[model samples]
Target: MSASVAASASARAEGGKPRGANYARHYWAFAAPAAAVVGAVIVFPWLFTLFMSVHDWKVTGTVSYVGLANYTHLFTDDRFQWAVLRTLYFTLFATLAPVVLGVIAAVCFAQKFPLRGLARTIFILPMMATPVAVSLVWTMMFHPQLGVLNYILTSIGLPPATWVYQANTVIPTLVMVETWQWTPLVMLIVLGGLASLPTDPYEAAVLDGANPWQTFRHITLPLLWPFILVAAVLRLIDALKAFDTIYVITGGGPGTSSETINILLYQTAFAYYDLGYGSAMVVVFFVLILLISMILLRVRTSR
Candidate 1:
């Protein structure tokens, strides 16, 4: 036993490689429980969803195997195709608006001011508020005749616009509401990144007589790209999965005009009782999100 132990110790010290491998193995052992939990909660559900997607699950008929039929059907389905377009449209504005506004807000808040803390707290309040409550409040504000927004517009001698009432304006109006609620979250993320950034560049830029814009362009933005990308990824995901706000605000519009993939999924699954179709939609949606994520990840890591 002593000879064997000596041989093992000698092997460990040869490159100190075995020790690292052992540590990694031990670490994995410790992590296994959490991994299992995650697999059970998230992975399994998605696997089941994939399984359901390939079947014709119905209330009355026996579940029938459909292979990739549902996915093929999605490509040809007009309503689903339209929802895809609408979702992409909403996502574009919703993601970009918040990120742009958030970066501006982060830059502003990062500077020292008298009431900075209080102001930041107030600014982030919308993000912390309950989604349902926020939707309800906005719903009241969207009321054309009684809404304070219309009152303000009319007082300013502008036309009182249909906020979420008109099909043409509903998606943009919802995007506006989304931007208000989420901009602070992106601001906070960017702020954290800004705080951690090395000050050497900025100090050097100041000594070099670079203006605020020049300094930001040369120093701040390059370093901040990673954080901004992270925020964009988060916002993209949130915007794609957005249902609560739209559901409460427009319930998918003056028709299907404002309907997104998420709304369509819900309507198909629950309202229409087409579980298999809904599952297929979910699968396609997941794949789309995964593709976007990969693209973003590539952009984030690339020079």
Candidate 2:
């Protein structure tokens, strides 16, 4: 009986009935393709960028080793310094504006109102549109003389100021454009969180004689903190990497006034043909993004 049982177990094991180790092997086989895809698409490029950051590689010639020269040069370069500062400024304004507006929009949309569905679709349309197309349309609207914006100002008996011509206004204009495009994304995220919230706390607050403002401030805000953090982090990272709209609208114009880090990297790589330096900038930007994300994650997790 023992011999027969041993033979049966061996047959079952060999006939696709996986043992413990074999199960693990099969599981890895199922996971390997996804892991390889992620590594190839994401990890490999990141590692390559890091490697290139420490070298002086030209587009046409042999690569030379440059220890920390690229990083040091970036610090000293006036254009790069300006780009970094401008990037931070953009991130701050872009992130805050959208988050604030998104919360308001979410609150408004959370209530049942007439044509609410249509209103949401309209609000989110800009985010779905092609960025390049939006940029082109805005560029026309921002034209100094004949643009719709200037025309409106003139009609109101106000002088038409150059919107994108001056360095001071260019960054703000870009921020406005970014905010217009991304606020809906924040709204959607916040709305989801709001929808998921339990009604009991709100009811209890009402019963406790809490006013609307008090309930929102004390209960809703705290409960929605995680979603807010998530939206802010996403917006921050995206704003840091903003390029297409600004590139199309300003082209980092008026003497690089609105140039973000991504724009700087693009100029370095393509216009200046300094592949190695550009790659180093990319590496620095990547590290900064990773650090910021980690910090945000830590804060969220702790809470």
Candidate 3:
């Protein structure tokens, strides 16, 4: 028996066999595939964008390195500046409206109500709808003369205003469309968090003779802060990068009134055939997004 045990031990040592190594080997194997995919899809594209940003190369020509000239031109360009401002404005309204509406909807649905499931499903429908489809529908609805929205306004004795045709109303119209499309997403996220909350604190609050508003302000809001922040951050990022809806809805018009950065970049690259400048704009936007994400993450972690 001793001889046999010694032989087994010797074989194990010679083979470098260890039980803990199996877990490590398995973990690396699983991680390797994901790491390779991320590097190929995300990392490579990011690096390419960075490299392209510094060069003055057309879509079909010999490439020329221009260092920071593209970035300098971006700063000096008035159209780019206006696009940045418009993008910021859109981001602010788009992020805030949905989050506020969502919280309210989640709060309402958190209580036991008849047809609650159906209502929740209805609310989430818009979120699942394709952006291109939504934009197309909204485009028809924003028609100045015969659109449903203007018709409703006329019927309700309100002024029948030009929506997409006029510069003044374009941004607001886009914001309204965006809010309609994205509020359901915010509602779903907030609803999930609300549903997952423990009931004991709410019960205790009621036992202490707290009213609904008091309970919400003191107990519910504080606990739901993390989820709210997450939703807001997600919405903010998406709003910053908004493209398709704006592209289909306004096409960055009535005379650049609704030209967000993404739209500007698209117009620059494909519309005007300024590939290098457009790539620079994209790189700057990417960096801005990364910085904002980091800041938001830091804030969330701190909380």
Candidate 4:
């Protein structure tokens, strides 16, 4: 018995087998359910979409392999091209306006003022509301007639303008709604960044006889850039995926003038029942988003 015990100890002191190896099967058994769920819910649908994109799929018609026909057609389709352009245009303004405004608001809010807490709370109220509800309220305010915005304009001796009813003004009007709802969120992010910043830089600038504008331009802006970039990235992604607000407010109206790629895809798949073409659009959109995300992430890592 002592000899057997000594052999066991010698085995452990040498190259003994790992305990985790014995439980590897159990680990896999526990993880299998979650992996199966993800495969079923997420993986299967995307695979199906990819399959449909390569074929001429329709609800009432027979499916036939198209071999990149849909993708080729998209290049020549004027409406699809316009939708892509509009999506880019809308995304740019929507992302930019909020970041700029939010930065300004954050700077102002960081200073001590009377009722600062109350003001911040009120400012964030719009962000807490559902996007659908916010869009619905803005829809009423955007009415060409019987809208309070126009009423205010007229009362101030200015001409009442058609807000979302006209093609030229629809994108801008929608962007205004986006900026109003999301600027507060950006402000909160920046405010958090401001709170964590070291005081050494500001103190050094003060000793150098820097004026307010000079200090902010040279010191504050540089230090806050990373935070600002983060805010911009978040806003950019949100603006790219924006559909509910645009859908509820304008319904892609004014004769397809306000239609973005998402709206176009919805109309193609559901309205026209061209599942193949719609899937193609979806693939393109996914590529676009992936490319943008990669670029942003690269920038972030480089910085």
**What TM-score, over all chains together, does every model reach?**
0.91, 0.89, 0.90, 0.85
> Which number leads on lDDT?
1
Could you give candidate 4's per-residue lDDT for residues 12-80 as a string of tens digits?
Answer: 667577545667888998889999999999999999999999899998988999989999988899999
- Ranking of all candidate structures by their lDDT, best first: 1, 2, 4, 3
Error of 4 at 97 (Å): 0.3
Count clashing residue pairs in model 4: 0
What would the TM-score be for candidate 4 when compared with the true structure?
Answer: 0.85
Query: How many pairs collide in each candidate, listed in order?
Result: 0, 0, 0, 0
Q: Write down the worst ten-residue block by lDDT for model 3.
A: 17-26
TM-score quality measure for candidate 2: 0.89
**For model 3, what is the alpha-carbon lDDT of residue 175?**
82
* lDDT scores in order: 0.93, 0.91, 0.89, 0.91
Model 1 misplacement above 4 A: 1-23
All-Cα superposition RMSD per candidate: 5.7, 7.1, 6.9, 7.5
Better of 1 and 4 by lDDT: 1
Over 1-303, each residue of candidate 1 has an lDDT whose tens digit, in order, gives: 999999999988896677767577678888899999999999999999999999998756769999999889999999999999999999999999999999999999999999999999999999999998899999999899999999999999999999888889999999999999999999999999999999888889989999999999888999999999999999999999999999888888789999999999999998988989899999999999999888989988885
Candidate 2 wrong stretches, greater than 4 Å = 1-25
Q: Where is the poorest 10-residue window by lDDT in model 2? A: 17-26
Q: For residues 61-130, write the lDDT of model 2, one tens digit per residue.
A: 8798998899898889898888888999989999999999999999999999999999999999989999
Clashing pairs in 2: none
